[model samples]
Target: MSILITGANRGIGHALSRAWQSSGTEVIQTARNSPGMEPLDVADPSSIKELAERLEGQPISTLVCNAGVSLDKFDELETGYAPELWAESFAVNVTGVFLVIQALLPNLRASRDAGIAPKIAIIASQMGSQNSPAGNRFIYRASKAAAINLGRNLAVDLESDGIAVGIYHPGWVATDMGGDSADLTLDEAVPGLRKQIDELTLSETGCFKSWDGSDCEF
Candidate 1:
């Protein structure tokens, strides 16, 4: 069995891949059309299907849907966010997550049959909080909120099959997405995320948590 992490070429995804690899766990790292790695555009159904076919019947202990985007980061509420930006963000951050899990269900089931409890970890955001202090980046927040809802429902549906699902906020980090002024570094975020993922079990499915293990409101 192995772990599959989407968008593993950089940022939090890359950090999680390294952490698992350092512990001698097999890791399947993906990037969006990147060379020397599995090319996976999470927004593309064809991409998800092809990867699923290729890994068919293989046991996957964990699947991390970490590929996401924040396109309207600098957009102002009055004049900036185009409709297309919302579509693009949802394609990657919301629908993409559901597609990956659907495509990989068989793999997760295989792990369960093999006496391993498989997992699905979604990299959502605290900004998606239902009681969010609204001011900016509504597009990003909406997409993440959808993802959290998806994870929760999926948890209920996949429970009979023994697959656990978790949605988490990977803290503000100094990545290309999270600017240098962010609160936590990748170093701090990845370890906390790892702890959450490693401890995930069927009983704890559908949890909304922060990288530091703090409880988050839906």
Candidate 2:
């Protein structure tokens, strides 16, 4: 089976790609500017279109929307989280995910036509959960909230076409974004994430899950 992963140059995405490759899965990795990565700027419509055109007839078994930014991590509550940051965050974290899926919808359909279940795995966060109460980094939280919502809606809308969408929290891994104090390592997270992605099905299209297959709130 073939898989397409965004932001696969580093962090959980990189780990996931390596794991998939090691398992003999055909993996198509994309990044905006990373060395040796196929050019794909998810925030740019033109770039997304170009990539879509380049992979025109290729059937994508899974599309993992892992390209995201955490611009609000350093923003302070009293004097940060600026207006521009909000736009930038949503542009990459939310809109980018939608645009990639929209541009490659046909490829996903091709996978279904080939009798390979087409799936969309969105790397969202528990930070987006309304059930959990947190204070700072409003932009990241809100954008992630939007992402999970988008994944849920896309799952419903695309179900008739046999596309399955699942949103996930990859866990707090020790990556640049997750930081050194994170709860998991890149090694610890990739396996469960791959399992979650592999098991995605039409019956559970809108499911929100953790990397370990537990249900995620909201």
Candidate 3:
């Protein structure tokens, strides 16, 4: 099987790439400004088009939209969460995910044509959950909520094409974005995430799940 992962230079993306590689799956790793990998800036339409063109006849069984930014992590409630930060966050976190999937629709169809159910795994966050209330990181939270909504809608739209779309919370791993104090290591999270993707099917499309395979509030 083949997989395409965005932002695979580091964090969970990188870990997932390495894990898939070790299992002998063909993995296409893309990142912004990363050498020896596909140069893709999900926020840039031209870049997404270029990558799509480059991978033109290749079948992508799974597309993991893992590229995201947390620009408002330290923004204060009273004085921060600047307007520009909101734009930047949505540009990459929400819009970028949609753009990549939109550009790669043909490639995903290639997998479906081969009798494989193409899967879209969106790396959303628990922060996006309306059921959970939190403070700070307003921009990140809102963008991720938009991402979840995007995945849900895509699940509906893409189901006829035999594609499954799932939104996932990768858990608070000790990545730069998650901070050193976060629970779960890459080792713990990657396997669970892989399982969630591996088991995703047309029947389960639009499901919001935690890395450990539990359902998450949409």
Candidate 4:
């Protein structure tokens, strides 16, 4: 099957690309500056459109909207919460995911004819949970919350078309974003995620889930 993954140059995205590639799956990788992948600046609509055109005719069974960012200079409760950073995070984590799904709807539609179930996997976060303990990382949390809603809406909207949608927390992976104390390695995380993807059914769409397959509160 052919899959398209964003932010594929590093961390979980990079590991996912490797896992899929090793399994003989065709993977189209995207990142802002990664070599051999589409140069995607998720903040720019023009850039997104350009990447869409580049992959226009390809058969994409899955689209993993894995690109994201966090505020670099702002403290959680600071009055100086950077609008620019919030914008940047939302651009990639929310808008970018939406645009990519919209752009690739046709490719996913075509998968049904090939007897493959089309799917969209959005890498959201547990911090997005409105039901969880909060009071930290405002921008990042908001962005992921938006992503969760996006996936839920897409799951509902795309159900008639037979495309499954999932919003999953990849856990605190040991990526640059996750830091050294993070519990899981990229190897452990991506494979578990892939397994979750493989297990997805129409019944599972619109659900918030964790890497280990537990339901996460929305």
| Candidate 3 lDDT tens digits, 1-218 | 79999999999999999999999999999999999899999989899999999999889999999999999877788999889999889999998999999999999999989988899999999999989977778898899999999999999999989999999999999998899999999999999999999899999999999999999997
> In candidate 2, which residue ranges exceed 4 Å CA deviation?
none
If both were scored by TM-score, which would come out higher, candidate 3 or candidate 4? 3
Error at 70, model 1, angstroms:
0.5
- Candidate 1, after superposition: displacement of residue 141 in Å? 0.4
Where does candidate 1 stray beyond 4 Å? none
Report lDDT per candidate.
Answer: 0.93, 0.94, 0.94, 0.87
Model 3 clash number: 0
Candidate 1 backbone collisions, by pair: none
Off by over 4 Å in 3: none
Error of 3 at 105 (Å): 0.3
Report clash pairs, candidate 2. Answer: none
Q: Estimate each model's TM-score.
A: 0.98, 0.98, 0.98, 0.95
Model 3's lDDT to the true fold? Answer: 0.94
**Model 4 error, position 2 (Å):** 0.2
lDDT of 4 at 154: 93
What is the lDDT, from 0 to 100, of the residue 217 in candidate 4?
94
Least well predicted 10-residue stretch by lDDT in candidate 4: 72-81
* Candidate 4 accuracy as TM-score: 0.95
lDDT of 1 by residue, 1-218 (tens): 69999999999999999999999999999888777778889999999999999899999999999999999998987899999999999999999999999999999999889999999999999899897667688999889999999999999999888899999999889999999999999988899999999999988899999998998989
lDDT of 2 by residue, 1-218 (tens): 79999999999999999999998999999999888777999989999999999999999989999999999887888899889999889999999999999999999999999999899999999999989968887999999999999999999899999999999999999999999999999888889998999988999999999999999999
Error of 3 at 193 (Å): 0.8
